[model samples]
Target chain A: MNAIIEVQDVSKSYGGVVANKRVSMTVQAGGITGLIGPNGSGKTTLFNSIVGYHPIDSGSIKFEGREISKMPVQSIARLGLIRTFQQTRIYAAMDCTQNMLISLPHRKMKFLDAFSKHGESDHAKAERLLEFVGLYEKRFLNAGSLSFGQQKLLEFAMALMNEPTGLLLDEPTAGINPTLINGLIDRLKRANREFGITLFIIEHNMRVIMNMADKIYCLAHGEMLAQGTPQEIQNDQRVVDAYLGTH
Target chain B: MNTKNIIFYVALLVLTAIAPFLFPDFRTQLATLWLMIVVAMTWDMTGGQMGYNSLGNILFYGTGMYVAAVISIGMVHDVGAYTDAGRLELMTFTERQYFVGAIVGIIGAGLFCSVTAIVVGYVTFGLRGPYFAIGTLGVAIAAGELVSNWGWIGGGQGISLPVYPGNFDVGKLFFYYLFAGTGVVLFMFLKWLYSTRFGAAINAIRDDEEKAEAMGIHTMRYKLTTWAMAAFFVGIVGGISGFQLIHFEPLETAYQTTNLGIFMVVCVLLGGKGTLWGPVIGAILFHFIKEVTWNYFLGWQWVALGALIVVTVVYFQDGVMGWLAHRKPQSPRL
Candidate 1:
C-alpha cells in the first residue's frame, strides 16, 4: 500500500520543554492508524506539526510524496488532507446542512447568488453526507442544539464534505456516550473501506484504539514508547508501564 | 428567498421611494436619515457581525467624504468657464462635473478604504479582543492627524464644493434618492454576506480562533474580507454625505472625538449586534430618541442616553433583538 502521509524525525519544543522529540510515523493509505498516548504524551503536538498547524524545529512531513512541512493549514487542507478538532468546531447559528455545505470544496455561488432564486446541486451532496452520518433528521436543526455525540457525527460529516483523501481526527470519540462510539467507529471504518480514505486517530480510549486500530503507536513524555499491532501493544510491558506509571 | 421577506423588502422600498413625492420637503431630511442608517449598518458588519468591535469606521467615512469633495470640486472647476458668444451652453461644467465627480469619489473611497483596511488588518488582526479594538482606534486617530496636517485640501478648516448652477432643491432631491438607493443595496448585500460560507467561517473564527484554524478555516482571510467589505460601504456613504453637504472638514469628517462612533456602536448594541436588521432598527430608534428627547432633556440628554446604555448592558446583554428572540419561543412553549 502507498504511504499517504510520512513524518520523519519531527521535533517541536517550547521554551525549555520539548513537546515532540524526534517522533516518526507513517500512515498508510486505506488503513486506520492510531496514535495512542497518555496525557501530555505529545500526541496533539505531533498532530499539529504533521498538519502544519505548528512549525517543526526539524524533520519533514510529506503528503502523497509532496513535502508539506511548511505549508499553511488551509493549503494543506486544499491538498486533500483535513483535520477535525477534539472539541466540536461548527457554525452554531447555522443549520446542520448549512454547516456541512460551508465545508464543500467549490461553492460556485457569488455574493449576489444568495439573494437570487437559485439552488446549488451541492445541496443533494450535503444532504447525503448528513444522512450518511445519521444526521439527516436534524438537517434543519441548528448545529449547536445537537448533543455532543451528534455534534461529533456532524463534524465527521463536515470533514468529508471536501472529499478529503486523508482525515486526522483528534479524539473523535472523546466525551461521547459509550453506545454511540461503536456507531461512530463503524461509520469511520466504512468510510475507510468504501471510500478508500486513510484515517489517523489520536485516542486515549483503550477500547476504541484496540478495536479499531490496525496498528498503534504509543507515546509517553514526548517520545514514542512502542509501535505494534493492537494485541502486541496490549501485551507490551513498556506500554503498560507508561500508561500505569508516571507518564 | 422567503416570499414574505421578499415582499416585505419590496414594499419597504416602494414606500420609501414614494415618500418624497408624498411629503415634498421631507425628501432631503429622510435621505440624511437613510445615510445614517447605511453608515451604522456598515459599521455593524465588522463590529457586530464578525465581533471585531472596531471604532475606526469613522476613518473610512471621513476619507470617503474628502475624496468625493476633491473630485467634484476639481472636475467642476475644470469645465465651469466658457463666456464666448454663439454657443448654446449645453450644461454648466459644474453640473456635469459634480455628477461625474460623485461617481469617481464613490469608487475612490471604496478603493481607498479597502486598501487601508487591508493594511490595518495586517497590523491589528494579530491582537485579540480589547487590544484589537484599541489598535483600530489608534490607527483612526493617527490617520485623522495625518489628514489634518496635510494642507492640500483646505487643511483642518475644510473644502467646500462650489454651488452647482442648477436649482439647489433639485440637486438635493437627486442626492437623497442616490444615497437612499445605496443604503438599501448595502443593507441587502451585508445580509446576504452574513449568510454565506465565508460568513460562516467568520462566525466560527469569532467563536474560537484556534478551533477554527484546526478545522482548516483560514481566519486571517476571513478577517481581511470582512474589513474590506465594511470599509467599502463606510467610504461610499461618507463620500456621498460629504458631497451632499459640500464640505470635508477633517475633524468633523474623521469624528475628532468618539461621539458619533459611540452613537453608532450604541445603536448596534441596543438593537442587537449580529442580526441583519439590528443596526437599521437601532439607527432609526437612536435618531428618534435624539430628535424627541434632546429638546426637553437639553444638557441631560446625554446622561439619559448613558442610563439607557447601562440598562441595556445589564439586562439585555445580547441587545433588544436577542431579548425578543428569547421571548418569542417562550410564548409558544408557555
Candidate 2:
C-alpha cells in the first residue's frame, strides 16, 4: 500500500526545550500504524505537526503526497486528516447526537446553511456511530456528564462521523476500563476494516499496539529509535531497553 | 408546539401588541426596555454562545445610529448642510419623507453595521479572552472619540433626525412597535439558529476553540458570521433609537459606553450567559430594577446598579437559568 502520511526530518521545539527533533515516519494507506513513546518523547508533538496543530521548526509533512505543514488545522481537517486529543476534546455542553452532527465535514456549507435543518440521514449516521461506540443509550445525555472512558469513546465516535481518510488517535484507550478496552479495540479494528479508514494511533499500551498495528515506530528523547512489524518491535533490544526497560 | 408553549407565546404576543395601549404613559419606557432586550440578546450571541465576550458591541450601535441618520438626511438634504448646526429651522420634512427615510434608514443601518462587524471582527477575532474584550472596547471608545472630532457628521454635537410625521402619541406607539418587532424577530431567529448545525458549531467553538478547529470547524468564519448577524439587529435598533430620541450626541447618547454598552453585558450576566430566555428575562428584571432605582434612589442610582452588578457577579455568576439547571439537571441539551 502507498504511504498515506509521510513525515520527513520534522523538528519542533517550545522555547528552549525540544519536543521533536528531525522525526521521520510513514503511515501506509489502509493500515493501522502505531506510534509508541515514553512520556514527553514528542509523540504528540509529531502528531500535532502532521495535523497542522502548530507551526513546526523544520521539515515537510505530507498527507496523500500533498504538503500540509503550512495549512491551518481546519484546512488540514477538511483535507480528510483528523486527530483526536490525548485528553479527548469534545463539545461538553452539547449532547452526543449534537456533537456527532457538528462533526460532519462542512465543505460546502454557507453561512445561511447554519439556519437550515439537519438532514435525517445525518441524525441516523450519528446514532449509528454512537451505537457503534456503545454510547447509543447515552446519546441524549450531555457529553460533560459522561465518565472519562465514555468521553473518550464519544470522541472516537465523533471522529468517525467526519468520514476522514486517515484518523490520528492520541492515546485512545488510556483512560478506558480494561474490560471496555477490548471492545474499543474491536470497534477500532472494525472501523478500519469496514470503513476503510487508516489509523495512526499514539498509544502507550504495548499489548494493544503490538496486537493491533501492522507496523510500529518507537521514539525516545525526541528522536525515532525503531520502525518494524509488531513482532520485530517486541524483540528489538533498543525498544526493550528504552521503553520496556530491564525491569 | 405543545399547548402550554403555544399559550405562553400567544399570551406574550398579545401582551406585546397591547403593551403600548395598556400602559400609554409607559410607551417610551417600554420601547427602551425592548431596546435593552435587543442589545442584551445580541451581546449573548458572542459572549455566551461563541465564547467571545466583546465589550464594544456598542460600536455597531453608535455606527448604526450615524449611518441611519446620514442615509435618511442624505436622501433629502445635502448631509453636510443638514447636519450643520447653524442651518435654519426652515428645512422641513414632508410626511412622506419622514416615513420613507425611517424605513430605508433603519434597514440601511442594519446592513451597514453587518459590513462593519465583518471588517472589525477580521482583526479583533485574532485576540482571545481579555485581550479580545479590551481590543473591541478600545475600538468602540476610539470610534466615539473619532466621531466626536469629525465635523462632517455633526462632530461632538451629533445629528438630529426628523420627528415622526404623525401625532405624538401615535409616534410613541410606532417606535414601540418597531422595537418590539425587532426584538421578537431576533428572538425567533435565535431560537431557530440555536437548533441548527451552525449553532452547534458555535457552541463547539465556545467549549474549545483549538479542538473546534481540529474538528474541521472554520472557527474564524463562524465567529465573524455570528458577530455580523448580531451587529445587524443591533444596528437596526440603534437606528430606531436615533429616530425616537430625535437628537443624540456621539459619546453620551449614541456610544454611551458606560451606560447601554456595559448594561448589555450586565443584563446577559444577570440572565444567564448562554440560554435563550436568560437575556430576555435578565433584561426585563434589570430594567425594572433600574427604573425603580433611578426614580427612588435618584442620586444613588449608579451606585445601586453597580451593587446589583457586583451582587450578580459575586453571588449568581451562572444567572437564573444556570442556577435552575444546576438545581435540577436537565436531560441532553443541544
Candidate 3:
C-alpha cells in the first residue's frame, strides 16, 4: 500500500519543554494503523503536528506526496486529512443530525439551493450516519443530552461526513463503556473495510489496539519504543518494559 | 411551526408594526428603541453565541451609520437641484452613488471586521479563559482609537447629513420604518442561522475552540464568518441611524462604541448568551427598565441597572435562560 501521510523528523516544543522530539512515522493508505502509548507519551502531540493543529519546530510532513507541514488547518482538512478530539466536541444545543450536517463542506451546496433542501440532504446524511452508529433513534435529540459513549460515536460519524481519506482518531473508545466499545470497534472496522479509508488511531486500550490495528507503533517519552504486528509488539522486551515496570 | 410559538411571533410583530400607527407622535422614537434592540442582538451573534466577547461591535455600527449618512446626504444634495418638477427624481445621481457606496461600505466593513477578527483569533485564540477576554478588550480599544483619530470623515466633530426638503416628521417616520423593517429581517435571518449547520459549528467553537478544531471544524473560518456577519448588519444599522439623525460625526457614531455596546453586552449577559430569544428579550427589558425607572427615579436609574446585572450574574449564572431551563424537570431515565 502507498504511504498516504509521511512525517519526517518532526519536533515540537512548548516554551522550554519538548512535546514531540524528532518524531517520524508513515501512515499507510487504506488500513487501520495504531499508535499506543501511556499518558503524556507525545502520541497526541504527534497527531496535532501532522494535522497542522500545532506548528513543528523542525522537519516536514507530506500528504499525498505534497508538503503540508506549514499548511493551515482548514486547507489540510480540505485535502481529506481529518481528525477527532480525545474529548467529544459537538454542538450541545443542536440535534444529533445538525451536528453531522455541519461537517459537510460548504462547496457541496450551491447558493441558489433553498436552505430547506440543504436541511433535507443534511437530515438524510445525518440519519444514515446515525443508523451506522446505532444512534438513529436519537437523531432529533440534542447532542448534549446523549451519554458520553454516544457522543463519542456521534463525533466519529460527524468526522466521516467529509468523506476523509485518512482519519486521526485520538482514543476512539477511551471513556466508552465495554458494551459500546464493541459497537465503536465494529463501526470503525466497517469504515475501513467498506469505505476504503485509511486510519491512524492513538489508543491506550490494549485490547482495542491489538484487535483492530493492522500495525502498531509504541511511544515512550516522545520517542518510539517499539513497532510491529500485534504479536510482535506484545512480545517485544522494550514494549513490555515500557508498559509494565523494568521487570 | 408550533401554533403557540407562531402566534407569539405574529403577535409580537403585529404589536410592533401597529405601535407607531396608534401613537404617531412616538412612532420615530419607538422605532429607534427597537433599532437599539436589533443592534444588541447583532452583538449577541458574536459575543454571546460564539463566546468571542467582542467590544468592537460599535466599530461596525458606527461604520454603517456613516456609510448610510454619506450616501443619503450625497444623493439628496446632488439630485435635489435637478428635480424642478415633483416627479420623484428618477434615480438621482446622488441616490445611485449612495446605493453603490452603501453596498461597498457594507462589504468593506464586513471584510475589515473579518480581517480584524482573524488577526485577533491568531493572537488570542491560543489563550484560553480571561486572557482571551483581555485580548479582545485590548483590540477594541486600539481599533476605537485608530478610527477616532482618522480626520477625513468629520474626525471628532462629525459630519452633518443634508436636511431633506420634505416634512421632517414624515421623513423621520420613513427612516424609522426602514430601520424597523431591516431589524425584523435581520432578526429572522439570525434566528434561521441559529438552527442551521453553521450555527452548530459556532456553538461547538464556543464550547471549546481547540476541540472544535480537532474535530476538523476550521474554527478560524467560522470565527471570521461570524465577525463578517456581525459587521455587515451593524454597519447597515449604523448607516441608517446616522441618516435618521442627519449627522455622521465620528464621536456621535462612536458614542455607540461606549454606551450602546456595553448596554448590549449587559443585555446578553442578563438575558442569556447563546439562546435565540435571549438577547432580544434582554434588550427590550433593559430598554424598558431604563425608560421607565430612569424616567421616574432620575439619577439613580443606572444604579438599579447595575444592581440588576450583579444580581443576575450571581444568581442566574446561566442568565435568564438557565433559570427558565432549570424550572423544567428532566425526563426520568427508562
**Per-residue C-alpha lDDT of model 2 across residues A120-196, encoded as one tens digit per residue:** 99999999999999999999888999999999999999999999999999999998999999998999999999999
Give the CA lDDT, 0 to 100, for residue B36 in model 1. 70
What DockQ do you compute for every candidate structure? 0.29, 0.76, 0.29
Query: Which candidate number would show the highest lDDT if scored against the true structure?
Result: 2
Q: Tell me how far the alpha carbon of residue A155 in candidate 1 is from the true structure, in angstroms, after superposition.
A: 1.5
Better of 2 and 3 by DockQ: 2
Model 1 local distance difference test score? 0.78
lDDT of 3 by residue, A41-118 (tens): 889899888888877999999999989999877678878888888987777776788777776754344432323334
Per-model TM-score versus the true fold: 0.90, 0.97, 0.84
Q: Using TM-score, give the best candidate's number.
A: 2
iRMSD, per candidate, in listed order: 4.2, 1.2, 3.7
Candidate 1 segments exceeding 4 Å error: A106-120, B1-7, B21-26, B76-93, B330-334
> What CA RMSD would you report for each candidate?
4.8, 1.7, 5.6
**Residue-wise C-alpha lDDT for candidate 3, range B248-300, written one tens digit per residue:** 55654554556676777777777778777777777777777777878898899
**Candidate 1, number of clashes:** 0
True contacts kept of each: 0.26, 0.80, 0.28
lDDT for B236 in candidate 1 is 86
* Error of model 3, residue A118, in angstroms: 3.9
DockQ of 2: 0.76
